[model samples]
Target: MTRTRTALLCAAALLATTLQTTTATTAAARHEQRCADTSDTRRGEARRVMDIVREAHRDLGLKAALVRVTTDGREVVTGAVGESMAGVPAGTDMHFRIGSVGIAYMGTVLLQLVDEQRVGLDDPVSRWLPDLPHGDEITLRMLGSSTSGLHDYVTDPDFLAQLDAAPFRQWTPRELVAFPLRHPLWYQPGTNWSYSHANFVLLGLALEKITGTPLERLLDERVMDPLDLRETRNSFTPQIPQPVLHAYDDERGTYEESTFWNPSWTTAPGAVLTGDICDLARSARAIGAGELLSRRSYRVQLDPGTVGLPGPTDTCPADVCLPQTEEFHFGVGVIVVNGWVVQNPSFSGFAAVQAYLPSERLAIAVSTTVDQDGASGNTAQRIAERIADALAPEQPLGG
Candidate 1:
């Protein structure tokens, strides 16, 4: 071929290469746009779920946030509605204490120690914590299952009053444990099931005693780090950040601001590091996948504790109850309701619901800054049910 003809052929090759590069770039952009569209669709679905709850519930005066993440590596959706209070700013990214839901995290830590053979779930409390009057009768399993006969300290008016009066006061686990220690047993250990935060408080102290490390450190090293949860941290001081939302007690005739309180005293018992809806949904999904515990330890968690509450609703089977579990009825630390296990409502500035269908690998998390009442639980249930229904349209809500 002549020089001019060869040069023309080279130009053709260069033009084809450029066209291919442009085609690939366009295809990449389209893929990203499609992913964004899917994310927005899921986010919109989540927002609509929250709207249904907001419009339907009148009493809660609720400000709600929700996040649903599917196992297909999709955040799907996250959005907030309502105000932190009647006249306050609209609630968004505000930290709400996850209340007893934190217990499940504590339960995970306890099981981690059990996995190491450092502690036995059924070992008598007397084996490690010998200071209590009835330590011999109580076992670590009972503590996790709420069958230890330990009274909940939150119900003690005097004790609560003391904490309320000095809500920011730094309290040691021993100081917090004293209240339950003063109360007599509700029954012999391993017999009855009750919702007692004190059991986990004792578990936290036991963790400290056995490991010579604070509960917060264990949480960071074991759970938080592995999960890559940045916002979650144990706070036992008044130095908690300022952007936190304040809560209210609507039980009174007039709605009163419950005040901007610190969680210094409730650490381990109720003090969990707080995070956004997305983070919580991720945590819920991780826990449901049994990524945090061994298979045998996971079995221990699912072993139901006892049946203490009113049986399942008429809409569901009789065996299905809240905090659903198998062995002791409590199912480790979570409640089994309608065969669906769940953690209690967090009572701090907000209430939290984290529920997942293990078979489906679908999880929903609802967090709200709202007043407590039937309304609070009802709203959460409705929103959670909607997400679950969307994911599992065949499964009916509880009767």
Candidate 2:
């Protein structure tokens, strides 16, 4: 029997292929889940979790955010919590830097172009942007997969100083590319995997060269507008609009206010978007159903599973490593968490997770602005697991 929340859930549900439902016992046992009709139940759980985290997590700040879940095109939960800042403003639609998560989404958009023959996956960087070292050797695929051998600009002391001094500065792809383009390859392209924003920065420039449009415009028209994601957008300018979240940095012993210019430097590397729980849930579902790309293009984004790439914690000897995967390899744009979950987090002030049970056509998205220990993937995983367990039909994990 469909519950009252089903209709509300449908409004926010993103498209996805149908999933088969197994016996409730099997569904419940396979994952830490619980069947409930009350969206309030999930919200309460998130609130409770946040209270504990805020008081104890190493990172002491938080932001306004929401979580949404859907099953077979039906919305299950939509709730926002916390204020953007202690006294400034509050809303579910506020935007924040998506950090590395932007890279994954960038890969998805680029692959879609490849699917349409608008571009090619194996195309060299030089084909689009000329006058760069190793332009002939670095391919789009290698850059997306983190095997491009480009050093990250963010690690440089000068880069960090600039970022700190001007957190709200708007930057262009050409300006951002200069950093890594000037450096020697950290390793042979395709020989290793390293997570560097520089790879995606270059990719963003290539995308501009291919489309003849700014990254923001292409992303908005192709991804957000089609989905009717009113609350999600790329803030290219330094002036943040209303209902924005205020970020903070613990500098030495003082907490300093920080603002992320969603466009400028971060662009394709990790900055083209900000969204609420509802839109994000819809986006995840759409991507999973192959709505954003053709089956061929979608396959490229999901290839981390088949290629068996090593992660940061993987037992690989190379400098570039695969992320630890208890389930499958990292897919193209997102990590395949525990065989079912997919998640992305920004270093700024937000983190998000999504998962689907193919058999049941059930999916869930959890997001938070809470930061834990310098954007540690391990911390994000723990938070994701907490929410996943609650959504599971079985008892929450751990006694």
Candidate 3:
């Protein structure tokens, strides 16, 4: 199977097998709390946008969903639906696991280091992670842009099996990278592009080694604190902080809570995080605007493809190394599609999307969780795409 398909299948299988069952009444209660006290502040199209979020959650059978949209960094509209847990109502302030959104933060920090001249994008990773396969040849740019050719351990059958066996197991970065490192490089470094969690894990480690600071602290100093994202913080344990937007799934044939499932396997220790929709919307603006980067650094962060990187090699076929198009291209840590810069991350029961339109200074952030029978996928991203269409009719997020 292709890597993306394999990863999705593993996630689906994981949702199916990981937890105990919940009663039908409890599941019903969770879904029934849709839009308990949804609030909106946008003018002209407030009700229209709020209706879209509410309808999408109900139609998609999401257990809980939160959405926030901002214009020029000012909150335009915000809404929440469904219960945080069986009987508790979800709110705009509820925190939920954000999955790979942390990848963007990693990329931003790397570019900040580049701006400071502490690290060079083209410098070999061997300078920090000398033991990695072909470490001497791989560059920081390759890791951040996902052109490093490292296998994604999340796609490894053995790793998936182990994860299924122990959903809450705390995985060290070494243990996670070992799975891909055990395999061969898909292609020579910078010769192709493929999304791999291993690349970010290594980049996180290298960042720590170079700065002598924890990844969480670096993120705070560079991105989170400066952006005033007080709600966003690393999750060192399985627990989602209080006022949690609990997630439920029927992947195992019965509705069950997967709210506190460990996410150590998702990314580096300090990179895995949970936050409310407000911070997500703010993050969309800050990261998208390159607010923390130099002009040259921001240019690289958004368009690393122009750095003369080679196309796909024979080993890295077209399916794995997708071609860049006007509507879609992978930038350093962001995905640019149809003039919108975006990041969407999905895990067991949670999914989130953050999208920014630079031309209009528009930002949309959505977080969602599936009901018992709802499909485990990118529900939030689809919802955000709809919202984007309504807000920016002239330039749809989809091409």
Candidate 4:
């Protein structure tokens, strides 16, 4: 997931624990089965990518990390470093929370519906959620592109305090959006751009209402199933399915287990998910190529800025808004960085980046964890950029 404003402020406010030895062994076996592949012909490239992962794991003091890359959706390279637990080595099969990547999935589903005439990107949300504030003015396109101007609940001080006080508390969608609804919009709907968890939450509600199907089912049918992302699934409780990568962080003074921390506050009920590195790599390619979307829908999803109406006030800040440029811009559920489509999510001691260079048909996915105090939250993204630079030096992964 893209970093929330509160996550940036509370960078040091995030750790892991001992698990049964049997559990570790089981996880290792399952990981091997899920990640096994023999088609890798780019040994030299794989070694180069592993060097980046190993160096990052040591230099950044990460508890564990994994990277997977594919060229032209055929030649594959995967690597891992450190441990999932105390003695359990990290593997490509181990699952970890993939925060904002879910947003990209939701956006893809919305565009698919648009292509099918099941929904319209410009349709006011009032058509689905009539009681929501300014629902009539906000459109699906605005929500998908984070241009709805809705206040980001994650930036609310009270919400941050509550989250720190009870890291394991499960939050409902209504409760999460209520924090933002209590405050006035940051700017008029469809006017300014700011990354808001509330926007995606509302998008989930609208999608459910429009299709009369659960969000999880809709994602499975529309995205996961078609792409064959077997490792991806929704989480209702704090539980991450087995073969897990234990995450550790020292944000709370002592390094402690944060692998199972409640993520219900992160996104919609069925969209919060954990997956293996392979799935992340696959998703990068599928989303970047927009294989399931029509040409028109793909174009809009890649550049929704065309529909974004600027507000009278300049509320665009460096943290929330990256000024539009030839090399950088926010797309529907995705970020374009130096012409490469990317999505990076960070939360609760886990950070990950999935980047795809459509020109080269290359996909790079990296997931990381921190164990040191005051560590930067963008560790995984930084590592992914290093690997991309090595593989696709012609197209630098720009800020």
Best by lDDT: 4
Ten consecutive residues with minimal summed lDDT in candidate 2? 30-39
lDDT of each: 0.63, 0.59, 0.83, 0.84
Candidate 1, residue 193: the lDDT equals 59
Query: How far off is residue 293 in model 3, in Å?
Result: 0.4
As for candidate 3, its clashing pairs are 16-251, 34-82, 35-81
Give the poorly placed runs of model 1, Cα more than 4 Å off. 1-50, 56-59, 69-73, 85-92, 164-166, 238-243, 251-254, 265-271, 304-329, 371-382, 393-399
Per-residue lDDT over 1-399 for candidate 4, one digit per residue giving the tens place of the 0 to 100 score: 357877765664431123456567776676566566657478888888888888888888788888989887764677789888888898777889998899999999999899999888999999999999899899999999888878888889999989988999999889999998997777777666778999999898888999999999999999889988988999888888777888876656677889988999998878998888989998999999888899998888889863344433555555664345557767889988887988999988999999999999999999998865635777999898888889889898858
Which is better, 2 or 3, measured by TM-score? 3
lDDT of 1 at 132: 73
* RMSD in order of candidates: 12.9, 12.5, 11.8, 10.2
Model 1 poorest 10 in a row by lDDT:
319-328
Question: Which of 2 and 3 is ahead in lDDT?
Answer: 3
Error of 1 at 151 (Å): 1.2
Candidate 3, which ten residues in sequence have the lowest lDDT sum? 28-37
* lDDT-sorted candidate list, best first: 4, 3, 1, 2
Mind giving the per-residue lDDT tens digits that candidate 1 earns over 318-380? Answer: 332233233225667665444454663655445667766576666677766555443545455
Candidate 3 stretches with Cα past 4 Å from truth are: 1-41, 250-254, 306-314, 317-319
